[model samples]
Target: MLLALILALGGTMFLQKAFTPKLGLDLAGGTTVTLSPVTQTGQSPPEEILDRAVNIIRDRVNGTGISDAEVAKSGDNIIISIPGVGQSEAIKLVATTAELRFRQVLAMEATQVPQNLSTEAPTPGASPSAQPSSTAKPSSTARPSGRQSATTPSASPTGKALSSALTAPTPGATPEATQTGTGRDQTGQKQNNKGKNGTPTPAPSTPPTAPPNQDPNAGINTQGIDPAVLQQFQKLDCADPKNRGQGVQDDPNKQYAACESDGSAKYVLDVAKVVGTDIDTASAGVRQGTVEWIVQLDFKSKGAGEWSKLTTTAYNAQEPRNKVAVVLDGVVITAPNIISPIPGGRAEITGGFDQVTSTQLADQLKYGALPLKFQRSSIDTVSSTLGSDQLEGGLIAGIIGLGLVVLYSLLYYRGLGLVAVLSLVVASILTYTAVVVLGHNAGFRLSLPHIIGLVVSIGITADSFIVYFERIRDEMKEGRRTLRAAVEVAWVRARRTILIADAVMFIAAIVLYFLAVGGVAGFAFAMGLTTLIDIVVVFLFTKPFIALLARLKFFAKGHPLSGLDAERMSTEPARTTTPQEA
Candidate 1:
């Protein structure tokens, strides 16, 4: 029965290990970021302060494109579990206080701005920092733009004629003269006046000279500015048509307009009146090598006509500027200089990008606005190397703990201790196999705490054996003639107490696991697993082993090592038993 029970438990554990998924910190790495309110007089912060802080922290985490992150309050402290956000950005995001503010760019030029520079700008709102330590490392500077140096990536390839962009070209000239020597015709043939291709019909090759005529629309007129540059920004407007103040006789607050240069010279853009929230849907995906994403922006009825007008103006421009900047969290992600006006308004951003970053951008834009700003309180990175060292230490401790338990139990309990030793061996096999299987199945990770729990449980296993042994001694004192009857009676009482003890532990563990945050959950889970293993060992291995021993002559006759004497069982004290008993 003992062997059968062991085999069954072992097999079941092995199967579970094979099929179950083990939990991982990264896969479900639940971390608690604790935010304590700044305490006056250096005591604990007040309840009201903590509550407000937690609310804001929760808001920031939810906005971060991380799924399943949670925040809750505990006695003057806020605990946040940034779950399912893997080890990388999880550390970066949580540690960031996200203390956003509209600090005016003050001066980008070597010259100072005039003090009266009031184009009434920007906005801000805040609750407080969401952590105990109010300190945060200063944010790193943004990567430098390449435009400051010629070596920097040339301002996103304009693809416009170089001459027009270098110095504005004329408003009038023959189409042939206006185009570059490398440009194409309606039939897609290269139109080179230099006779690089096509039939060189024959040129009398007149010498280049100053124009005799000052006609504004005349041939090869190289004058004041470029017509192509004028066409590029002719109708740019920042305010969406639908989003002007209540009734628009034109909002005096609209701050942006089409400029001679691309937005490079502009630092501030108009506040979005009709934000991304008005749009119904947006999604991002990767096709081939490019990151392709689309936004389906439908305007509020009031905004639609205005948006159409904005597009029409851009559409009717000399060169036609059709694209608007795709902005998010106050940063421009991409600006595709459209070749034609998009009255439809909805647009696509196509560039080389992997699937993940594209999806994250779309999610942020779709969410519109965040309710609260988060201040990252603390961030910690746990390395796999440390995890491995911890695992090794735990294993060594478990083995040592088990060896000590075995050495002492054998020296003290004699034959009774053997039962405990066997039960533990079986339990160890089951636990080890289950842990491995669970690693694969549930993504389970056995931290050092779990190993310690297993080692401590060795004492719990021994206690059960001691309880049964003591119960059997009581039965012997009550004058039981048969070993089997005494064994059976003792088991009934011992099983009850054993079960009750395990049940209480299991219940406590369950409650703690669900309620406690972070590392405490690991503690609770290990306790619960061990409590379960304890019960299995008792019901299947212990009881069956004791039952099988009852029928053995050595045990029935009361062997000395077994600490059993028939005389002890029989109250008359005649001592009818084996010589070992004497």
Candidate 2:
């Protein structure tokens, strides 16, 4: 028992930074984001696509080093809960489609679009080519919008209405895709207006300025992109996520409108020259002599030829077209000038990226892109203070339950009750140590259900002691053995019963853990762990302590209060009766 306690406590103390178990979302505070699929062409994507998207999202969340984060699907929506994360950071981290592409910059134009422009679907018969006049002079000043930049035009009801109709919803997008939020923090509150119906509502603040790596004068193919396409580019805003209007998931063989994530500028990008699937592997590292973090990309054999071809084209092209844009989900991540053809099948993206952002990018690149886009359905956040309250309540409930068990044992079993109480303490120590160690090393957080599981285990441990005590009393009542002998015989029977009972419990827990979803699985896991601990404590501590106590005079003599009085347990009373019998 001493060795067990030492190993459990020592291992936990060594592995865990803190002595406490990690808490789940409800008890530790965090952010949750829900994403629903957006089909490309009015038909639902294949099951494989949705499954692959889930895997990609998992990789993306894991890239942030959030081991306790939970990602699961409910019906059609994918839910992501990240403990100890903020709303803005969580959204920025997991909300991206990460559909990376290497596209040429065809044209750059600045035109302002109204914030309240309705993003409604166009009439079925409307001409596909109908667009705003290309003759309109370009504005020099463009403000950041969402994750893109477009010149904000003077407010005109006519212009707003026209822009609304022209920039229709994607063919298969939800009629009114909307994102709601449980704003427990400033970041969450700010992101509450992300989506309304199918429209991209304006954010209260302008997007951040682009990093220093972005070149303002990167050459664009002014002669290549049609004026109408350029006009559309002028209306685009990267700041408003919803502004990625109809057909934004462009065909690989066609020109497209896109923006920089920081809303620094907008671009008319040529067809994709290279895609994410071409990447064989990606990793983030600091440059040899600099503190700047970079993402190194390695391509597969076929991708090598493609990469060589793309680089050669960029190297030979005019100014902006010579700069290949690394675009993700129609937003330009970076556009670096091609100085020479890179045929080595490897390249590095150097930006003013910190370790966190670089690592996130590398993970996105390493995992293949999602086949379908997702609209942010909702975001929820829990404050740490609230989580603390929940944790406190759970702890109080558990303490009360434990106290009741201890009280019952002491009141009923007399001296042996001390043994039961001590056994419980030992079990609790082992359980706590196990939880903490598992939480630290295996990313197992103690959620509310898991806490309940632990509390319920009090009964399980107490039950084992009760079984052994009763069996020992039964043996002594037969009057064929001393207390020591009774204990030995009782243990043989009790051990089998204990094993059978614990086996049933462990099997049930195992089944639930594999079949159940979400928090229930955590509960199942905790239950199984404690059940196993119960068996260990009984064998290592409870039975051994009982045997030792039986050897003591107080217990072996069957003192009335020892809870093991052999005479009191015997069915036959003492032969000598009182005066009434005489």
Candidate 3:
């Protein structure tokens, strides 16, 4: 037992650098971010929706592998506290809505644009050379009859433009494509234009406000994409950090405007043709035979049908329309062009994703999205000094309790008190070593409540020692046998009581640990741990040491200070004889 104790201590110290107790936010001083749900109608969301949002947020935070994060809901706000995290990380984890939506790309533009192209603004009469005339007539050859057949391959002019734009790879294009799904148009125009002065010109206005004739309900209607939304997409400056914040959710059935997460591009996206629920699973891995990481998506039965129809429409649409936007939390995570009518509802997002980013995205898709959008209402950093003061106070209280237990044993148990004190020292050493090792490997934190639990355990350990000693002295006082025999016999009887007592505490601790949350759970965990350690010390150290001491003249001969003076005890005849016979 001594050897085991020594090995544990040595191992913990040796691995101290790699494994250390993680402190809670209250102790470590980390970042706290509060998020309030943003409802478009200016009223709080339904309680069920809010509850689901909290759960989704919890899953996302857990997926980040941050063990010390606490996600809770207070009133209508969700509060997230992460220990050992910076403000930026805390905000990133909680603020992201992760509401995955699949929308068609109505238009794409360079985020840096000149002048607010607010559709609400009157037409500007600038130089004919500088301002591309918005009213330029559609060429005769490109414009198709309004009654063009929907079934024929090239029936709809827009469909011909889209199929030609999205399916064929652009000349000189590299294998690595940005997630913003754009390729080339039939007109041989680059989907992305590097505009002058960082402000590029707007995308061609919504195609003549006409729904594609191929599938009258191809559901690919441009008529609903408000010109104002298009203007907002045109004016969007991806470089501005302020523009990156979560915004109001657009009607899922209407065209919406959003910017790419990296601020690389801005886009006008068609309403939701697919959403997170339609997705069955998503995984991230290195592309087969390549080093690049990509996220692969698989859709459910209904989602698959929608995905196929959406891809088919996108494949047959014009430049920006051929692209599909992957929006998360009202922000464009990526937009990829439909290279083909993707069948089977399986697709790959092959942006310039690294393993870490791809894995993160995959996690978000697989875990499902939050039901409500959240905006960061407040963020603050907590200092460790307050935690340090509380810890210091707890330690002082624990030491005082321990000291009292030891002092009482000395005064009452006499020479037996020495045994009790030594046993306690051993238990303490064992408990400390176990906690440090567990903290390092299991992410256990030593909170104030846990400290109190440990203090309580000191008294419990002393009680076991007292029980065994008193039993042995009682046997000797009855003149039944020698000290060694008394020690041996008393242990047999005392162990049963000790086991039952410890068992009750152990069971209670287990129940409390599982049923409680927060700090109370921490206390229960400590209690359970120490209870087991007390058992180990009693069997391996306490019993053996007491048996060994029973052979010493100091105790066997019943010295006054030995706490078992046979002369001072009752010298009654053996219990087999009655008092009248004696």
Candidate 4:
């Protein structure tokens, strides 16, 4: 089972190219800083307070999944290094003391419509005249005319005849020299009035107002509204579903909104309330009925009071209740006008959310809570050159260390050194496979420390071989009849000792892995992994292989190339008449 597991793990590492360890600062390349207590009135922060703050910052950092992040204390300050991740994101992560707020729009650009006309009013039935969709554009042929009608007695003879005579065109008129002595109509014919001098007199302009069809819905035709107002209208980007693209979301300055919707009613809206900061938590989830996604927020006590008050006012208004918006991290998550005062502190923001969007909101809100209010210390682009140099240096050291191990084993062990060599070969195979597989599965990298662990493990593998071989020699001196029998006896003792040693090594690796910080933890983990593999090769490939060799004449008859020669072994003398055959 053990051998199978080892082989499988190794194979997986080799075959898959998947590994995603949280990278260290050097490899990932990002900024680092120490944040000191911003003392006021020369008072320093208490050590305990600072430590608690660090813990919260650490949680936010680790949630990021970047490996080998260094968060430590230096004197009264905290040092944070963000490698291989965006500094802006990290800064945002820490900086948000989760100061949530809901601010009312006090005043908006004049182009934005007011509280009454958000365009969400249900169009009960379609009217061809109301066909201007929000996406519709103005057309030249659809121009409109404006007129004012009065309830007057044109029925009186003088009034009636005077209007007709003054307004009427002459019967045989070439062009009416019907120049009005007063401000009266050449009303119709004045459009083509005659003049003796023929100075080409222009038609008199009428008082300006919205033309019958030059509607606000045609949107701020410059003649209809101020040009500066038109510019403000264009800058609008309303995220509101009803007037979506009509104007920007609730501007802090928007006390009133004036919207020119496509064929929709022109309305002015008054913001009754501002969104409050202080939501306890925000989560995104599916709403009931249609399974639409929504952001659910639980407000802090004070914020709840503020929201309830706002809702109360909106609910009592003549219009339908529920107009409060829940803004998260700034974006309006959901802004449903209140139909009634929200009884409790819970708010569900239902826009057009999906499962993925809900999950994203939940995640953001989850980590967004922080212990410390962060101030960005510094930011700059990082260079990978230093990391490359370190990697090269680490590799060189590993090669040198491996070379020494090979040299020592070869010179001292002589013929038996081949077993050591073979064990190393197997260990390397196992170790390399594991590292590769771990890289794929867990995103591990081969740092200098990790390489050192592998190289050092070669000695551990060699030790197991020496222990087993020495055991075999001991058994032979004790009258074990054949090399194969002696091999079995040695294994019994060698196996127990190997197991004990491996247990110790594994425990140490785990303890160190958990306690140590930065690259040291990687070292501990790699060491533990290799130590287990070493045991596998010794028992499966090493012992069984030696057993097979003992059956061959070349090795059993003590060939010099065989590490297990008779001369190296202490053979027991014949015990004459020693024991009756049992």
Candidate 5:
């Protein structure tokens, strides 16, 4: 059963196309990004803040399913090294400020054509309208728009309308309008919006609010906004690259104008009622009995009351006023209408989300907001030539060590050495197959330290065989039992010692793995894994094979070459005939 199970697991490597174990950044080479902190006061960020940022970035990278990523603080910059090439998305995710805020949507305008509206079949033999009809105004009776329910597949008129607008040029948009926008589209497709100098124009900062936080609903009353700010909003085109709002930092105390994440729409949002700090936890999951993905949020105690108040106000408002915009950084990630007041500080944001996107969004919110902003200083691709050379050297050393172990065993144990060699072979096969399978399924990666750990385990495995063999020889030296009887008696004593020793090593490995990070953790993991394999081989193969050999004529009769000759062993003194026995 054990051999068959191992073979079955090995088969999965072919199915997963994971023929080789995943290599770490040191071995495979990868991209490294450096981000310098940007503080409001133009001073260096404190050490504690940088450390916190490193932890958050590390969590975000790991949360995205990338393994063996290295995040560390260097001087005033944060350096992130990810294994493999073309990891642009990971680079972007780790560098994002991820400032999360919840603000009331005062007004909204679609930037792209809605998918449903654009794909509608025109009437046959009917004249096509020159212009698309305007979307109907949302009403109190309307099903909540923008956000999709987790249990349903029904499209949201608001969400579909916004997402559709991103694909093609907006109707009636001029070449000048399109050429002014510079960032990639919501799907990460780069757009051609370079300036006459062939460089991208920086996004302009959001217009400052005239009266910040004075009126809670100031954004809803367009008259209350400064003419210049309102004019900026009116002229802001979501299709324009500079207006997509990628890097703008907006103050939570002020009303701001921004485009949706997908460049589908634009909105004027009121002061933030709740921010990332208010979020106690965030997670992504599917609704019960449903396959649709959703992001759930839990608010802090004070934030719960504020959340309830915000929802109640929106639920009682009209049209776009009833919607709440979830702004990350300066972009509106989503604007969902509140059908009813959501209490208890728990809320769900459901839209067109798959497992991957939902988890990404959840991780961003769960890690909390960074205390300071960061700008990417540079991105460099590391070379693996050094790692390759190191690997070659390490392998050569291991081979030499293994060869010596095998040579010593053969010279000392003679015929029994063959059993030790076969046991080593079996252990190696199990370890290799297990690591490959785990790399495919659990994102395990092999690094230099892991290699060292594996090489060291050879001695650990050989130690087990030596213990059992010596115990058998000790029983033979007593001259009270035959080879067959000694095999069983020796095993009874040897296994107890073997289990205790392995147990101690396994416990140490577990502690080290949890307490350490990066390469140290990898070493501990490799050590623990091989130790377990050693136990399996000793109990299942080594003992059983030796028992079978003990039944053979050459071994049972103690041939001199068999290393079990009676003359080679020192026996107890012969018992003298006692008077009663004689």
Candidate 6:
């Protein structure tokens, strides 16, 4: 069964076309990015801020399911190394400041390039009479069939009527850009001008200005909004990437015009009611009684009161005004409508979220906002040749170590050495297959430290064989039982010792793996894996094979070359009772 299982796993690897284990940055070479801190004041950022950024960036990378990525703090800069070339998405994820804010949705419009603005420039002093081509009305009560309700508060239940408004597909919408967690209009075709990271890069040009008399919020209530903000909203073309506001640090005291993360719609959002710092904690989970993924938020004491007030105001407002926008990185990720007053400090943001995206959003929110902003200082591609040289050195060292262990086993055990050698061969095959399969499925990668761990396992495996063989020899020297009987007795005693030793090593590996990071963790993981493999081989193959060999004529009769000769072992003389003594 074990052989068949190995064969099946091998077949799966072949089918998946994963011949080699994924290598780490030190073994395969990857991209290294340096991010320099950009503080509000031109002074250098403090050490704690840099350390905080490092931890957050590392969490973001791991949350994306990319293994073997390293994030470290240098002098006033953060360095990230990912185990693949052209990791643009990873680069963007780490570089983004992930500043989250909750603002009321003042007005919304479908993202479109105005035909007049595209064809001809607007006349200089004439009143700009062109209104938005299409206005998107808020539909917070629109629920998709067969899905759970969008938001449900612990204090007050809103029922199914309140759905995720942003997830509802807007008619006549075009997909031009990519957002982290926002829903897309599947009915529209994707645009071709998107950059490699799925962010649209439109042609660079000045945004057309509106006349002084124009009111962008013409029919809406613009009570608390500034006139200047309204003018900017009137001229803002969300379809243009430059106007989408990628890295702008929006002030919480001001109103702003922002594009949806997916660029499906544009919105004029009110002043921030709750900021990212207000969040006490955030997490992602599946909704009870349903499989829909959602992001749950818990606000701080003061923030909770502010959130309640914001939800109450939105619930009492008109169509579009009833929705609240969740803005991150100066872009609206989702704008769900307020169905009822959500008094509790806790809330959930549900939409077309999958497991990966939900976790990513949760991580960004949980880590809180960075104390300082960052700009990409340099992106350098590491050469694979360097990795190759390091890998070659590690492999050579492992080979030398393995060769010595095998040589010692053969010389000391004589004919019994063949069994030890075969056991080693089986253990190697099992380890290699496991590493390859795990690399393909779990994103595990082999690094220099992992190589060292594998090499050390050679001695561990050989020690198991030596213990059992010595126990058998000791039993045979007593001249009480035959070779087969001695084999069974020796195994009973040896296994106890073997288990204890392996248990100790495994425990140490587990502790080390959890406490360490980067290459040290890799080493611990590899050691633990091989240690388990060693136990499997001993119980399933080594012990059983020795039992079968004991039944052979050469071994049963204690042949000299078999390393089980009676003369070789100091056997006690047979007891003969004298006639008088009897």
Which candidate number maximizes TM-score? 6
Sorted by TM-score (best first), the order is 6, 5, 3, 2, 4, 1
Question: lDDT, candidate 1, residue 341?
Answer: 27
lDDT of each: 0.45, 0.65, 0.64, 0.50, 0.70, 0.71
**Which pairs of residues collide in model 5?**
112-165, 113-165, 181-240, 181-241, 182-241
Off by over 4 Å in 5: 62-68, 102-109, 114-236, 242-258, 267-325, 336-368, 414-416, 441-443, 474-493, 514-517, 539-582
Candidate 4 has its poorest 10 consecutive residues by lDDT at 142-151
- The ten-residue window of minimal lDDT in model 5 covers 164-173
**Model 4 bad stretches (over 4 Å):** 1-23, 26-29, 33-46, 59-66, 74-77, 85-368, 383-390, 410-416, 439-445, 571-582
When superposed on Cα atoms, how far off is each prediction in RMSD?
Answer: 18.5, 18.6, 15.0, 20.6, 12.4, 11.4
lDDT string for model 3 (401-492, tens) is: 88888899888778888888888888887787777776665556666667888888887887788889888877776647777788888999
Off by over 4 Å in 2: 1-5, 36-48, 51-77, 87-380, 384-390, 572-582
Q: Which 10 successive residues of model 2 have the least lDDT summed?
A: 164-173
Model 1 vs. true fold: TM: 0.41
User: Candidate 6: deviation at residue 78, Å?
Assistant: 2.4
| Model 1, residue 164: C-alpha shift (Å) | 61
Better of 3 and 5 by TM-score: 5
| Stronger candidate by TM-score (2 vs 3) | 3
Candidate 4, residues 1-582, lDDT tens digits: the string is 647866677556446644333334665476676665554445667777777767666656554222445578887667787665566656555544442334322122112223343322111121111122233211101000111010010112222111100111001101122224211121111133435765333332222345766753342213323344445444444424355322132434343333322211122233324343355766665433234455566767876676677656644532211123334433333233232344356555433346755655454455554433445565555654347678667667767776776677666555566667777777776676666666544446565567667767767777787788788777766765566677788899999998888888889988888777666887887888888888778877888778776677655555656655555554534121211211
Q: Candidate 2, residues 358-442: lDDT per residue as tens digits?
A: 8778877787676777888988775554476777888899999989988888788888999999999888888888787777665
Distance (Å) between predicted and true CA of 6, model 2? 3.9
Worst 10 residues of 6 by lDDT: 120-129
For model 1, the stretches where C-alpha displacement exceeds 4 angstroms are 1-390, 566-582
